[model samples]
Target: MTTPVTIVGAGLGGLVLSRVLHLHGIPSTVYEAESSPSARTQGGLLDIRDYNGQPALETAGLTEEFRKLILEGRQAMRLLDRDGNVLLDVPDDGTGGNPEVERGELRQMLLDSL
Candidate 1:
């Protein structure tokens, strides 16, 4: 038998891959460089696209929980010129392909799912 799949780094991609594999009855061990979960700041924000990241999370069985964490109307994208003039500002109409969520919160959600 093969040794358990070893995953390095507890970042989004790594954690997502590990989670998906585990869903299919594959065993894995995530080797994070940080001493613990809060060893470093997770980052700013994340937008889970319905095509890739969201689907992967769905396959891993965390959609409903993820939905609870979705930050609606966070897609307020603004395009500004170098002179600090707001060229264009788009409000969140709930039609965006990506939904923004706090990085730390999203990571915690994934961790909890696992």
Candidate 2:
């Protein structure tokens, strides 16, 4: 008998698990509550952690595709106070791999890769 793993939600974690399972020739289904892909707007960008998110993406075979979703110059993050004054601005010199892309776009890419 073969055991099955059930996953809920199509977010980053769920999608990543699905992809890896597929690579291993394991069957799985993703249960997303959303009626449609565009049912709701995804959250803001995410800073993928080097040890966690990045490695998961690599395992899911979406590293290359995910790279495309990387918004150019989005890495230039800024820290602002309540007054909305420019407290600090860090320009992305294309060196730091950490990128800031819309969560929806990234999710779409991950789903497509799977």
Candidate 3:
């Protein structure tokens, strides 16, 4: 008898789990409360770290695809005072440990991969 794997949510982790399971010929189902993938904005940007996120993407065989989605300069950070005075500003030098990518793009890519 084969027991099926059940996962909740269609977020990045859930989608990645499902994709990996499928890759190894495992049967699984993902239950997302959202009516659809686009029910709402995926929101903001995400900084996927090389030490952490890169390994996961490699494990999922999505390293190349993920690399293509990296958005340059998104990792830059800026701080301002209430009066809009610049307190501090740091620009992405393209050598940061983590690269920023649009949240929606990452979600869509994962969904598409699945």
TM-score of each: 0.81, 0.80, 0.81
TM-score of 3: 0.81
Ranking, lDDT, top scorer first: 3, 1, 2
lDDT of model 3 at residue 107?
85
lDDT per residue for candidate 3 within 1-114, as digits (tens), equals: 557899988999998888888888888999999999889999998989999887887888898899899998887899999999999999988888898888899888888987
- Maximum-lDDT candidate: 3
Q: Rate the local accuracy (lDDT) of all candidates.
A: 0.85, 0.83, 0.88
lDDT of 1 at 75: 83
Sequence-dependent TM-score of model 1:
0.81
Which wins on TM-score, candidate 2 or candidate 3? 3
Clashing pairs in 2: none
Alpha carbon deviation, residue 110, candidate 1 (Å): 1.1
Please provide, for model 2 over 8-70, each residue's C-alpha lDDT reduced to its tens digit, 9 standing for 90 to 100.
999878988999998988888899999977898888978776677778889888888877877
Residue 6 of model 2 has an lDDT of 84
**Residue-level error in angstroms, candidate 1, position 66:** 1.4
